[model samples]
Target: MSISASPKSRLLITHVLDFNSIFLFKAQVSRQSLGVLRDMKAAIYPITRPTIGRKKIPFRPYNTFPSGLKAEVVTFDE
Candidate 1:
């Protein structure tokens, strides 16, 4: 399964964690769909720093996003 980001979602890409997420994400994304991020200076970062849950759970297990891509939320482009 691929992880996709969209304006409809409240979650945003903070960093890249792994290759699996990136490959799956890219696989699901089409050439036309990539225009939205590529031209917007999207970037990937890792999430292994353990910053989730607002640091409320110090002992919580955090998965690393070795390949998370960030994109701009463009409106009226459709």
Candidate 2:
């Protein structure tokens, strides 16, 4: 997937399948990118509930850094 703010700025994403069967995603920012891409700061929110009939859903803050990547596996019991 590729996300772009303009013709010169873009975030390129590539997916790789490892030998362990885990999917790894890699992202690269173009050299001419500006703003958020240049700063490399992003907020990610994971939805824990269904939003079918909800008017508002709380956002859980997840921080991302340029130094490294973090991955989490969550399981819910019904």
Backbone collision count in every prediction?
13, 0
- Kindly report which residue stretches of model 2 are placed more than 4 angstroms away from their true locations once superposed: 1-20, 36-78
Please give the CA lDDT of all the candidate structures.
0.27, 0.27
lDDT of 2 by residue, 1-78 (tens): 446332222122333532222222223333334344445453133222221211111122323322222322111111
lDDT of 1 by residue, 13-32 (tens): 22354323211111123333
- TM-scores of the candidates are 0.16, 0.18
lDDT over C-alpha atoms for residue 35 of model 1: 56
Q: State how far residue 46 of model 1 sits from its true place (Å).
A: 30
When summed lDDT is taken over every stretch of 10 residues in candidate 2, the lowest stretch is 50-59
